[model samples]
Target: MTVHTAPAPAATMFDVRNPGTGDVVGQYPVHGEPEVAAAVERAREAAVWWDGIGFDERRKRLDAFRGVIARRINQLAGVIHEEMGKPHGDAYLEVALVLDHLAWAAKNAGKVLGKRKAHAGPLNANLGATVEHKALGVVGVIGPWNYPVFTPMGSIVYALAAGNTIVFKPSEYTPGVGAWLVDAFSQVVPEHPVMQLVTGDGSTGAALCRAGVDKVAFTGSTATAKRVMATCAETLTPIVAECGGKDALLVDQDADLEAAADAAVWGGIANAGQSCIGVERIYVHTAVHDAFEAMLADRVGALRAGADSGALVGPITMPSQVEIIRRHVADAVASGGRIVAGSGSIDGQVVQPVLLADVPEDAAAVREETFGPTLTLRRVEDMDEAVRLTNASRYHLAASVFSKHHGTAIADRIRSGMVAVNSVFSFAVVASIPFGGVGDSGFGRIHGEEGLREFCYAHSVVRQKFASPLPLMSFGRTAKVEERLGTIIALVHGSK
Candidate 1:
């Protein structure tokens, strides 16, 4: 099928389509450099008005923004359901989760970013030092098509709450949802352009990075992240990359086979398995591998993909992803894996659920991210091997460990950002845990205290009540005082 490009603009806008039916959803402006530059200029003006409002007033406005989203959850979910082809209920859940993060950011921003007294130690106690977390200036956010609401909002809300103005570039595939969110925030803070939308394709994202924004926040593939970093490097723009994850799940022999199988199916197939933290591999204990695979096959076989009520799986969001999915499955099968459920093509967007067992370690299906409704099962001799193989991949985003007694220990050993001991995607729902990855999965964090700080910079300040008998910063400082300071520091923090 030929991919439909976005409608014509002064610049070419991306064509947004409904994945399940291949219907044209809508089109948006492909904002050019001039428009985005203007948006950032406006955002700067807005930041003054916004940052001056102080935390209390901003908190109220942010809360009102949350209400706007909460009241219209289903309406937003419908757009997500169509544009991304996630199940309606699941889409609703995604929107609701965004609202929760918005609330968390607003409620916690002051405490996290506010100026606070820091221990000056014996040396600096007389210096009256304090540490302040200040917002970085205008921030540029480049969003992804999958989980359009939840993903970008992770950056947008946190950035705004920390007093930074946001100029967002949403995925062209789901610009409507992005526009709706900005519009909702406007209703609460009409006085400032605190959060503005700059809709376009990769060029727009490129514009935002070089358009003089202080920093950029990106969520996408690692390959693209390297490019984004290179672009930002030109301007020395610091970036937070929340990229892809080839996450794994390790099952110990003592694990509940039924629970492990259930998690494997859900983690690999939810949202048609398009999640960044989606479970892509299963390293089952040899003792229980057969039982787990049998149960997984039974469960995954009953799953359906469509725009209908009975559908559990949904269409592939991006059309180009079709060939990628087919290739992964074909590679695994040819590498001696067996498909126990649906396989092959379905239509323009929808693809069938697939289960592969006995897949070789070197198969592309096991080693890379296919981002579709597929699972590769391999047996390991023991839990030790499970941990080793699970961490073998360069990507360490999220993982799950299912063991009745050793779940937490096994979870801690897996080298992923977040792990669920006996659940699936629980970290996302928790609201207080940091969400991000290590290595190829990308760096920086976007939830909890860490998320709150991602948008701010630390500042240290000191005030003197009187002329210090021991002065530092001044050329007049005595060498005798310098020696005393060294002794003081060693007496305090350097103690053994």
Candidate 2:
């Protein structure tokens, strides 16, 4: 007898287009709710095997994964450049940053998550305590199109290093890039599906939040984050949202005009200003405002945005963002701001870098996240006013301070989660520094020791070495023991 089952219906499909030319770069499966749920279920099984391997063994596999990425760095960079329309050099730089983070997470995970002894006070001298960060089973990572490699790796790598299995949902615009990453990891650790990919749009991400994953690490706009949070709330699933930011750069009177101008331009316009930490506003002290403005104008005048090989800035990845950029620039000019460089124009998906000066403090260009290659400059009386204006924004993911002498001092006064002094985007490159923000920029970190711990839950164990002379955990304690305990507590802590 021959028995046969009907072939499963073909999965839904979608096309990924290149923003630069609107050409079909690739086609991907549109993974829906059932597919997402199945991936998470598989991840749960993988998580057990991954967790049981222990940190030392996991480190070996992670290091091997890093080696594979390093060997094929240029190939991955090409995919990033093609899908996202970022310059090849910029794509390569972002990939290199990922390698650095991979090495850091692999090298430090054992120490950061490994069991360690905790101090037992004299009141509990008979007890020994140890704590370890255990993996939270499976994690769902929803990534953004911009800086797809670096941004998603910030969550994906850290989660994997912490021993949690991952089910990734890359942005719809960059599914090929995401697929490449997962495929590379498979080549290195072939035994288990420690990392997997599911490709789709916003609804797919919502499906992931409802797919029964232990935690969801999301990187996108603040508005989208709120929606994802709402979906996850249904299952009470914890989330880490790395959302949008209106980051700023503050220039003091004593700042080096050339260095500050260069940093501000690059920080604001690099990656076509799609970075969450990209500087959108600049505050200059009146003492050096004119000099800085002239320097900025001269520098900005030479840059261009195009689809050509030499262009520093490329086409906007999301076509819808081009109109948003237009609206912001129009609003800035209407609010009495002056455009000092490049015509505020959008042709197809290519948006020319627009620099506006004297923009109203309340204008959309200043208050909202444009996520485009636009910079708004405002002159203040001194560094104090600069800091005040910078801190006034609703989003505060990161900022940069440019002052020769008061660099660190000024950085300390900023309310952002991370700040770069004398340089721009420096904190992101340092794997040891935590990356996240408060308020509308969203909460939870994705890098460094805090990042490794983000995908884990603490497990504490206490062992009794001997019986306590006067046990507080027992019901048979007498009044004399209670009096002695009260006296010890008062003597040790009441004086303060």
Candidate 3:
């Protein structure tokens, strides 16, 4: 006799709270394994219909989805600000960039993924060969809360453009934003659940990994990413992880001190420094270290963390992150590091910017990813020393180099997947450049041509146009024919 077990039922419910205030914003059901598996099955069914439609029709639908998002950009931004605690302006910027990516993916999908002719070598003179990229049937996306709209949309938009359906499991901290996005998309394409949403905590995410989707896309911390990978490994499911990073910024002696200071302040403290590619460490040449430190301190002093309308920095989104931020600051100061700018203080969820100078490379503040409004400054003897220090970390996601004459040369030496020359975070806004990292920062890309193909599968086709002059594949080949073939191979390839 064979045994069969029933799917698990939906479990408990949780409340979404505003981090700035401890008030409950909304409530969501904690979907269980059964719900997650059902969502993936529906996505699988929808993928068939979605892929059957031609690229032109798919473009129309995707463009319509983009239109819906654009029209309600402010509304979506409001949700992001409320749930994730980022400033309204910063939230708006996140949504705007997502819109740009959507437009690029819809416009370039056909040209990038369509079938193209391939040249058949002289050895196969009578064959026609071509290659095309097809959609992976269904994709599972586990998103993050920091930049909820922009980060997950990097996978969602590309997957949809590639003609695959999506079952998105957003971070438990920001389910409202995810629900809003899916609702807006549904208004555009209502026939099928082309883009579905399943709200829950980590258990739901783990379930999605075991739900048999064609591929899973995850964006989170390095520690959490490992757990996600382990769960996916149980089912032999493929996953793309855009994990954490302790990114760095390098300033050469020839660099503009004012510009470097400005970039450092913004890159390190923006969004309360919650971004994966956010600048956590700054390595400046010893010659200009003092001047740069002064300018950065002034900039940091001008910034304030509050929930008020005039405040530029918002409160920390995740509650657990506040302790980590405090620990890193305490650790830096305990290791003989000097506080240069704002005090390393935290009152409730709002944490003021903490700038530390002369911190050792081995300190936790410099070694681990402190996803808060904190910056550590270090002085290096030369650009070589700066590059050496920058490349010495375990996490290498993105980096920035500020140099007057050797920006490109300095950028090339860094081990990060992407680097900005004379700028910071510039690679993220550009739709054509790939976004991802190597090593502990996580593998697999999420943007550009590589990103569009990330949710797709390559397909090749070959056809015989006529019979070959020499029948080598046949079992009845004469010994003389085999000898002639060997002689021809030796004459053509032996010299090389």
Q: RMSDs, each prediction?
A: 3.8, 3.2, 3.9
lDDT of 1: 0.85
lDDT of 1 by residue, 1-496 (tens): 1111112355565678887777798878888888888888888887888877877777898899899899999999988887788889999989888878888888888888898987766555456878878888899999999889999988888888888898888887888888777877778877667888888888888988889998899999999999999999998999999999888988888888888788889888999889998989989889988888889889988888877767888888888888899899998988888897767456767888888888888888888888999888888999999899888998999999898999998988888889999887889877777999999999999888898788888999888756666778798888898998888778776977
CA lDDT, candidate 1, residue 201: 83
Off by over 4 Å in 1: 1-11, 471-495
- What is the Å distance of residue 461 in model 2 from its true position? 1.1
Residues 222-312 of candidate 3: C-alpha lDDT, one tens digit per residue: 9999999999999898999999999999999899989999999899899999999999999999999898899999999888998777889
In order of appearance, the predictions have TM-scores of: 0.94, 0.97, 0.97
Better candidate by TM-score, 1 or 2: 2
For lDDT, candidate 1 versus 2, the one ahead is: 2
Q: How many angstroms is residue 292 displaced in model 2 relative to the true structure, after the best TM-score fit?
A: 0.9
Q: Could you arrange the candidates by TM-score from highest to lowest?
A: 2, 3, 1
**Predicted candidate 2 versus true structure: per-residue lDDT over 50-129, tens digit per residue:** 98998888888888988988899999999999999999999999999888899899889989999999999979999999
lDDT agreement of model 3 with the native: 0.90
In model 1, the Cα lDDT at residue 245 comes to 89
